[model samples]
Target: MKKRLVVAITGASGAVYGVRMLQVLSQLDDWESHLVISSSGALTALHELTMRRPEIEALADVVHNVRDIGASIASGSFQCDGMVIAPCSMRTLAAVAHGLADNLITRAADVMLKERRRLVLLARETPLNLAHLRNMTAVTELGAIVAPPMPAFYNLPGTIDDIVNHTVGRTLDLFNVEHAGLLQRWQGLKKTAALVKESVSREHLISI
Candidate 1:
């Protein structure tokens, strides 16, 4: 059987993260992607990506209605490998933290928690308040990974795509998803420093 992953996109700022994730998952023949997009998520994607809902939905193998409480993913018996909420909005995070299960997105997340499956939340917010921090802490205590998509300077990304890909790649890593060539792996700093020194030395010789 193919490995199944539930990808939920909420009304977060970085809707592109979820889109990129689905795009990547579509490449893996052995993996199946089940997608759920909240109403706000669709609106956000339309605004940010300038893509219609159908275009975004086309990237996934399966799409579930946000209001469908009885979807396969909403139940623990559906047997999914894991779930990821890319660019997880604070509202969704709170819902998951509180075990709201008010909608299919939160309901599916609740199932993951109850089933002890991997649950990764790409929490997107900055200058967080106490409530946000508490909700993050609460979810962590419940066995969910709260991964914020902070950019890495070590990669020396030259473009926005590089930075976004790096974050997506890291999120995939939490699920042990194989996304080769998505992001540059960090070699040790000593090795990188030596390379930099070598380039600088060559520059000095040329200038002399």
Candidate 2:
């Protein structure tokens, strides 16, 4: 049977991360995605990314409203492989850390933690205060992986899409997902130079 992956998007600034994750998951055959979005997430997505709410909703196999606390995902028996909160807002993070299942996203995350399943949170914020640190520490202590969407300069990304894909690729890596051609891995500059030189030399030889 295919593995179920729960994806939650809360009220965070990086809405593109959530959208890219859904797009990436859509390409995988062995993974089924159940999506949930907070109401504020919808607003942020529209205002920031100019994405229609329906466009985001259509990306998932099943979309649950954040208000739906009694959804199937709330229970630990849902048999999910993992849960990922892309662009996890501080509000949602606090709820998850405190085990306050006021919404479906928090409830699902709580279930993941209780069941000892993988819970990856892509926390998006800067200049985090003590409260943010405490919540992150609390969740990490409970076996949740807190991954901030920090950009990697090593990838030498040239475009906005490159940065987004790299972040999403790293996020998928936390789930042990096999993704190729998404982001370039770090290779020694000498080796890369040699490879490029070899290619140029071959072309020169062909021209001769």
Candidate 3:
């Protein structure tokens, strides 16, 4: 049986993370992806990625309507390995934190929490207020990982796509998804220095 993962794309600014995640996970033979996108997520996709609803939905093996509370994913018996809310908005975060099952996204998330399944929330926000902080803490207590998409400069990303890919790669890591050697994983300082020297040597040899 393949591992099942539920992916939710919220209204947060980084829709590309969820899009890229679906794109990659769809290709993995060992995993099946169940996708749910919020209404505001569709808007953000249009504004941030210029992606239409169908375009984004096509990336997943299974698409669930956000309003369909009776979806199979809403039940813990569906047997999913985990759930990830990429670019998780503060609104959705609060929803999941409070066990509010007003929508499929939050409902599925609530099921995961009650069932003790791994739930990763890539919460995207800045200058968080006390309410936001408390909400985050609330979710943490219930076993949800509040992961904000903080990019690492160590990769020396050269483009916007690079930064986005780096974050998407890390977010997938929380679900134990392999990158298929696409993204650069962080090696220790010794290995990094050696890699740098090897790259320099290769460049020097190329010039020679």
Candidate 4:
């Protein structure tokens, strides 16, 4: 059977993660995407991506209204494989951590947690305050993975899209979904001697 994954886009800096997620998922035959975009999410997409509303909506298999708390994805019985909130805002993080289901994005995430399903949040803030850390810790304690999309310079990404796709691919790894061939896995370092030297250096530093 095809797996269903709910994807939410929130008001955060990395709108591209959400957009790239939809674009990648759209090409996969084994998975279906349910999308929810917050009011602020839409505004951010326009400002950050300069993408039209229709263009954004066109990428998802099913688009949900942020105000529709009664949507199918809002229920625990919806039987989706998992949910991902790409570029998750700290506000949304606090709400989900506190069990606030005022909006569909938060509501669906709440359901994912209650049902013991995988819920990945690409938290998009730096210089985190205590509240943000507390919220993240709270959600993590409840089985939600707070996966901030920190860039991997190790991948040697050539462009912004490469960086985004690499992060998206690893995020999708949680659901066991095969990415659209964009994920670059880390093989053993070309110079094993370098790894040995680095490990020895760290050990010596600790000893010192």
Q: State which candidate has the highest TM-score.
A: 1
Model 1 alpha-carbon miss at residue 32, Å = 0.3
- In candidate 2, what are the lDDT values of residues 104-182, reduced to their tens digit? 9999999999999999999988999999999999999999999999999877899999999999998898888888888
Better lDDT candidate (1, 3): 1
- Candidate 1, backbone clash total: 0
For model 1, the superposed segments whose C-alpha errors exceed 4 Å read 195-208
| Cα distance off (Å), candidate 1, residue 156 | 0.4
- For model 2, where is the 10-residue window of minimal lDDT? 184-193
**Model 2, runs deviating above 4 Å:** 189-208
Q: How much is 203 displaced in model 3, in angstroms?
A: 25
What C-alpha lDDT does candidate 3 achieve relative to the native structure?
A: 0.91
Candidate-wise lDDT, in order: 0.95, 0.91, 0.91, 0.92
Superposed model 3: Cα runs more than 4 Å off: 191-208
CA RMSD, predictions in order: 2.6, 5.1, 4.8, 5.0
For candidate 4, lDDT tens digit of each residue in 1-208? 7799999999999989999999988999988999999888889999999987679999999999999999999899898999999999999999999999999999999999999999999999999999999999999999999999998988788998888888999998989987656767888687777989999999999999
Off by over 4 Å in 4: 192-208
Q: Which ten residues in a row have the lowest lDDT in candidate 4?
A: 179-188
